[model samples]
Target chain A: MTTTLALLVDLAAIVLLIAGISMFRAPQRARLGNLVAALALTVAVVLVLRRHNVTGLPLVLTGVAAGTILGWIVAVRVTMIQIPAMIAFQHGAGGVAAFLIAFVELTRSAGALTPVTRFSGILGLAIGAATFSASMVASGKLAAKLRSAPVSLRFHNGWLWLCAAFIVGAGIALLLEPASGAPAYAAGIIIVAAAAGILFSIRVGGADMPVLISFLNATAGLAAAFCGVTLENRLLIAFGAVVAASGSVLTLVMCRAMNRDLLKVFAGFTPAAAPAGAAPEHHEPKSPGVPPEDPFLAAVDALKEAESVIIVPGYGMALAKAQFKVVELAGLLERQGKQVRFAIHPVAGRMPGHMHVLLAEADLDYEQIFDMADINGDFASTDAVLVVGACDVVNPAAMTVEGCPISGMPILLAHEAKRVIVCNLDSRPGYSGVENPLYESEKAVLLWGDASDSVSQLVTRVGGEA
Target chain B: MLDLAIMLAVLVCSFIIGYLLISRVPPLLHTPLMSMTNAVSAVTVIGALLLFAVETTGLEKALGVFALITATFNLVGGFTITDRMLRLFRSDEHHQ
Candidate 1:
C-alpha cells in the first residue's frame, strides 16, 4: 500500500509537470498552468518527505518557511526594470542549491559511490559552482553595480580553455578513484569552474548579455539534472533536462537575433569596432540638420498631423522608468485616430525581451507591438517615427558604415519615415560607441531630456492641442 | 547499469519534448517562460528531502538543510514573480 501511494504521487507530479510546460505555450492559459505546476510541486514535496520518513520535520518546515518569505519579498519588491537582474539572482540561488546537494552527496559517500554517481556528482559540482558565481557577476553588471563593458584578462580565452581542460581532467581522476582524495578533487573542480564562469561572463559585453544569461541558465539546469543522477531521482532529472533543452533553444534564438556565432561567444570573441582612423566622422554629429526644436511642441505637432506613428523604445527608457509614459503617449495617439504601434528590436533593452516586459507592465495591447522584421517595412509608409530613448537600433550606421561594431546588425529603418523624432538625454553614442547617422538626417529632430519627462511633456502638449 | 540506461533514455526524451514545447511559446512571453522554468528547476527539493530522510552525519544534515532552504526559496519566489508578470500581460478587457 505504501509503495502504491508513492507511485501514485510520482505519477501525479509527472502529469502536472507535462501539463504545466504545455500550458506555457498558450499565453492565455499560462497563469493557470503556473499555478497548477507550483501546487503540484508542493504536493510532490510533501509526499516525498512522508514516504521517506524524514526526521526533523520542524527544522525542514522552518527552512522552507524562511526561504519562501525571503523569495516572496524579492519577487514583490522587484520592478519591471530589474527583472533581468532578478532572473540572474534566481539562477544563482538555484545554482547554490544544486552545489550544496552535490557536495553533501560526494562527501557522505566517501569514495564508495558508483562510477555513474561519481561522474554526475563531479559534473554537478563544477556546473553548480560556476553558475552560482557567474550569475552573481551577470546580475551585478545588469543592475549597474559593476562595469557594463567587457572586462577581460590579458589572455582571456587562454585562461578559459585552461580552466575547462583542468575541470575535465579532475572529473576523470575522480572517476578512476572515487574513494581516494575525493573531496580534494571536488573542491578543486568547484574553484576552477567558478573561475571559468567569471572569466566567461566578464568578457561578454552588454550587447551579448541576453545570450550569456540564457546560456548560464541552461548550465545551471544541467547541474541540477546531474545532481538528480547522483541522488537517483527521476523527477529532478526530467525537469532539469527540460530546463537545459529549453535554455539551449533560447540561447540559439538570442544568438540568431544578434547575428553572432555561438561558438565565438563561448570563446570570448565579440566583434570589435575597426580602427577609428578609417571613420573618424562616425563619432560626431556632423550635421545638426534642422536645429534641435522644442521637443514637446515638435512632438505634439508631429502627432497632430500623423496618420500612423511608430514608437521605438530602448534601454534608456528602461533606465528612466518611462514605459508607462510611452504607453500613455501611444494611447493618446490611438484616441486621436492615429494608428500607433511599437517597434521592438530583439536586443533593445539590457536583457532579452526586456522591452516587452516593460511595455506589458504598462498595460498596452500586445497586438500593437511588432518585432523588427514585422514592423521594419511599415516605417517608410508611416507618417511619423518617435524614437524614444533608443539610438543604436535606429542608427543607420549599421548599414552605411563599414567595419563598424554594429555593422550588419539588423536595425529599424526609422530614417525612411516621413518625419523622425528622437527623444534622448543627449547626443551621446549608443552601447556600441558609434554615433547614429540618423540623428543628423534632415528628416530627424533631436528631443533632448530625460525620457520620462520628455514623454510626459509631449503627452500633455499633444492632449492640449487635440 | 540498466537503471542508468533507462534514466538516460528518460532524460533524452523529456529534453526533446521540453525543447519543442518551449519553442512554441511566443517571444512576448519569454520573460515569464524563463521565470516559470526557474521555478520548475527547483525539483532538487526531492534530493534535499531524501538526504534529510536517510541517516547521515551532522555535516551532511546541515548541507541538506541548506539545500532545502535554497530550493524552496527558488520555487516560491520564482512562481510568485512569474504570476505577477503574467498578470501584467493579460489584456485589460480580460481583467474586467
Candidate 2:
C-alpha cells in the first residue's frame, strides 16, 4: 500500500472513532457510538494485518482467538458491581501489551534506533509496566481483594521519588550508552517504575478511587502512544492519544465533582484518621413524634404521606446490594401518585457513574434519575427524602462543618427535605470520618439496619397500603 | 524527521479532538466512555504484530505473543463491556 493510502485509511478509522465518541452526547445514541468505535478498531486491526507481510500467522491467530474468547466470556458474565474491577484489570492488560511490545522492539534490535524512537521506547517500557502494577492494586481494591482504605507506608512519597530518580538515571544511561547490557538497563527501569506505580496508587483510597483509576487509564494510554512512536505507526499513535484524552477528561471531572485536589491526592495525602471519641455520639436523629415507638412505622407513615419523593443512594447501598428493593420501593411510591426521582451524587459509588449502572441493572428508568447538580434544588421542596445506605453525600457537614476532609465538598442537600428517612447500617460517619449533622436534624428518621430489608419492608407495607 | 513531525501532529490533533468530544459526554455515560477508550488504546496491538513481521529472537517472539494476547483481550473486553453498560442506559423511547 502507498503511504498516502495508508494515511487515508488510518484517518478514516480515526474519524470513525471520533464519531463514535461524539454520539455519546445522549444515552440513546451512546450504544450506536460504542458499536462505531468498535468498528473503527476492527478496521485499524484488519488494515494492519493486511498491510504487513505477517509471518507466524497461525501463532497470531491462536493469540487473537484466546484473547477474544476470554474477554467476551468475562464481558458477558460479569455483573455491574464487578465493572470497576474488570475495567481496572483491562487497564493492566493494556499496560502489559504496551510494555512488552516496547521491550521487544527496544531489546530485539541492535543500536540502529533513532533517538526519538529510543526515548519513546524507554517511556513505553516504564509507563506500561508501572500502569500494569498500579492497575492491579486499583482492581484489587475495587474488587475487595485488597484493603479498600488507603494503605500508607512510612515515607511513601520519599520512596516514590527514590524510584523516580532511579528510573531517570537508568533512562539517561540507556540513552547515552547504547552499548551491551542495554536490555539490563531497560529491565531495571521497568522494575523501578512498576514499584513507583504501586507506591503512587496505595496512598489513594475511598472516594478518590475513581480519580486514581481513570488516571491509570490515562497512563495506560500514554504508554500505548509511546509504543506507537517506537513502532512509527501513526494510526496507533492517534488511537492511544485519543484514549489518553478521554481518561484525562474523566479524571478531571471526578476530581472536580469531589472538590478535591488532584495533585494533593497524587502526592500521597490520605486524610488523617479522626480523633477518638469526638464523633457523632448524639447524632441519633430526633425523629418527629413517633409516640416513643417504631421508627420503621414512623418512616413508613412519612413515605405514605409525601406527594413528591426523591431517593438518595450512596456506596453503602451498593455494598448491601439493595438496588432491586430500592427500585421496588420507588415503584410503590410512584403507584401512590407520588412523583419519585433518584438524586445521584457524581462521586456516589466506587466509580464514576457507577450508581446509574447499578440502578439501571435494577431496571429503574433512566428518566427517574437526576444528577446532583440537577436535583439538589428539588430536595428542598420534595415532601420526603429516602436515603438508603448513604451517608456523606447526604451529610450536611460537607456544607456546615469546617476544616474536615469533606468540608468543602458539594453534597446532595438531602437534609433540605421536609421529612428525611435514613435506611442505613448506623449513624456512624461516612468514608470522610466527619460527623453527619443530617442525622441530628429534627425532621430526619433513622432506620438503623440493612437497607435491603428496610426497603423490602417499605415495599411490602406500601403494597398493603396500595 | 518529517515522519516524526507527522506522528506528533497526529498525536496532538487526536488529543485535542478527543478532549473536546469526551468532555461533552454526560456523566451518565462516563463509565462506558472510559471502557471504550481503554479498548481503543489497545491499538498498540499494531506494534505487537509488527514484531512478528521481521525475523525475531525467541525472547522477542515470546513477548510478541504476550503483547498480542493481552492487547486483544483489553480491546475486545473493553468494547464489549461498554456495549453492555450502554445498552442498560437506553430509555423506553428506543424500544418504541
Candidate 3:
C-alpha cells in the first residue's frame, strides 16, 4: 500500500511538471522537461517498491539514473531535426527492454519451461529483435547514412524459403527444449530475424518512416503488455496498452496521408513504374511572362489598393523563422487599412498543422487563418498570393502525375491566382526531388530571398520603415 | 484501473491531436519535434532501467540490464543523428 501511494504521488508530480513545462517552451525544450518528468515519476514508483523492501530497488534506481543522464546528455547536445530518429531509437530501446523483461518473466514462471512458454517467449523475442533492427534502419534512412532500397534476389525464391525454414526450425527447437540454456542458438535466431528486418526496412525507401516506426512502437508496447501479463503488473499493462493503441492509430493516419492502403504498403507495393510512352503529364510554366515588379513597392501598392489581404503561410515560412516578421507585416498591412488572413495548408510541414503552431507562437489570431479548401477559391479574388518558401504543395503537378509518389496528394492550386508572388530562396525542387513547374507558370513571379528577410522587407515597405 | 483508463484516453487523444497538427506544420520542424519526443520516451526507459538494476529477484536484475541496453541505444543513437542534422544549419553562416 505504501508503494502504491508513492507511485501515485510520483505520477501526479510528474504530470504536473510535464504540463507546466509544455506551457513555457516550444517542442524542442518541452522534450527535455518531459525526460525530467519521466525520471521523477520513476523515482516515485521506485519509492513505492522501496517501502516493500524490494531487494532490487537500489540496483534499479542506479540503472535508471545512469541511462537517463546518458540520454539527457545526448539530447541536450544534439540538433533539433534528429528528434524523429531519436524517437525511433527510444522505441527500439523500449522494444529490447520489453523483450528482456518478458524473457525473464517466462523463465521465472516456468523453471523447466513448457512448450507454450517457450513459444510465446520466442515469439516476443523475435518480434522485439526484428523491430529493433527495422527501427535502426529507419533511423539511418532518416539520417541519410544508408541507402534506402528494396533488395531483390535475381532468379531465386530459394533464399526466402531458407530464411523461413531457419526461423521456424529455431522456434520449434526452442519450444522443444525450453530450458535449452543454449544462448548460441537463441542468439543466432535473433540475429537472423534482425537481419530480415534490416533488409525489409531498407528495401522500402522513399516512403515515410512514421508508419514503420509506429508499427514498431506498437510491437514494443505489445511486448511490454505481454510482460505485464506475465508478471501480473497492472501499471505496465496500462502503459503498454496506451502505447500500442496510439502507435496503431498513428500508423493508420500516416498511411492515409500518403494515399496508400496500409495493407499494400506492408505488402511492399509500389505503383507500376512509369510506363513507356507515358509523356509525363507535365505543366509548362507560362513564359517567364513579365518579370515580377519590385516587391518592396508592390507591398505599398497592395496596402494602398486592397481592403483585405490574405497571407498564406507554408513550410517555407517556418524554415525561415519568418512567423514573427509575417505577423509584423500583417500588423503594418492592417494599419494601412487592409486586413490580413493566413492561409494554412494541411501537411504544410513534415508533420501536420506545423504552420499553424508556428503562427500561434507569433501570436496570430487563429480565426484569421483558413484551410486550403476554404482559401483556395479566394486566391483569384484576392489582391495577391504572397507564397513564402513553398513549392510542391502549391504546384499543379500533384493532381496531374498519376503514379508519382506525391501524384495523388492534395495540394493548394496557387497557380490559379491572378497575381502570384512567390518568396522562395532558390530554384531547387521540393521533397519530391523534382523541379516545380509552378515557378515557371505565367501567373507566378518568383521573389527570391530568405523567408524572414523577404517578409521583413515587405513589412518595412508597407510601414515605410525602410 | 480508472487512472490507467484516463491515462490511456489522454495519450490517445494527444496522439491524434498531434498527428493532425503534423500536417499543418513545416517540414523543418518535424525533425526537431521528433527529437524532442524521443527524449520524452527515453525517460521512461531510464526509469525502467533504474528499477531493473537493483532488483533482488533474478528476473528483475535481468530486466534492468535489458532496459539499460535499450536506453543506451536510444540516447546515443538519437542524439548522434540529431547533432549531425543540426550541424547542417550551423555551418550556414547566416542562419537565424
State the lDDT of candidate 1 residue by residue for A370-466, as single tens digits.
Answer: 8888999899999999988898888888888987767787889999999898888777787777777787777886777788998898888898778
Task: RMSD for all candidates, in order, please.
Answer: 2.7, 2.0, 7.8
CA lDDT, candidate 2, residue A429? 73
Clashes (candidate 1):
1
| Per-residue lDDT over A1-466 for candidate 3, one digit per residue giving the tens place of the 0 to 100 score | 3255645664554454335224223333433443553454355355445544445545655665666577667666644444445566677776666556545544444554445445655766666677778878776765556664444444223554565577788777666655655354566667877776665566554344556766766666555544544443344443444445545655665666556666556545343344456444432222345554564564456445666676766667766878789888887777766767777665554333356556655766555677776777877677767778777677677787665656776677666666566777766665554456677766565667788987877776767642
Q: Predictions ranked by DockQ, top down? A: 2, 1, 3
Query: lDDT scores for all predictions?
Result: 0.82, 0.86, 0.56
Report DockQ per prediction, comma-separated: 0.70, 0.82, 0.15
TM-score of the second chain of model 2 compared to its true counterpart: 0.93
Q: In candidate 1, which residue pairs clash? A: A111-A179
The regions of model 3 sitting more than 4 angstroms off are: A1-58, A75-79, A103-120, A143-169, A204-207, A263-346, A352-382, A400-404, A424-429, A432-437, A448-466, B1-63, B69-96
Give candidate 2's error at residue B82 in angstroms: 1.5
| Model number with the top lDDT | 2
Q: Candidate 3: deviation at residue B55, Å?
A: 8.4
Angstrom error at residue A84, model 3: 2.9
lDDT-superior candidate, 1 or 2: 2
Q: Candidate 1: where are CA atoms >4 Å away?
A: A1-12, A269-287, A292-296, A400-403, B92-96
Q: Write the per-residue lDDT of candidate 2 for residues A406-443, one digit (tens) a residue.
A: 87888898888999998988777787777677777778
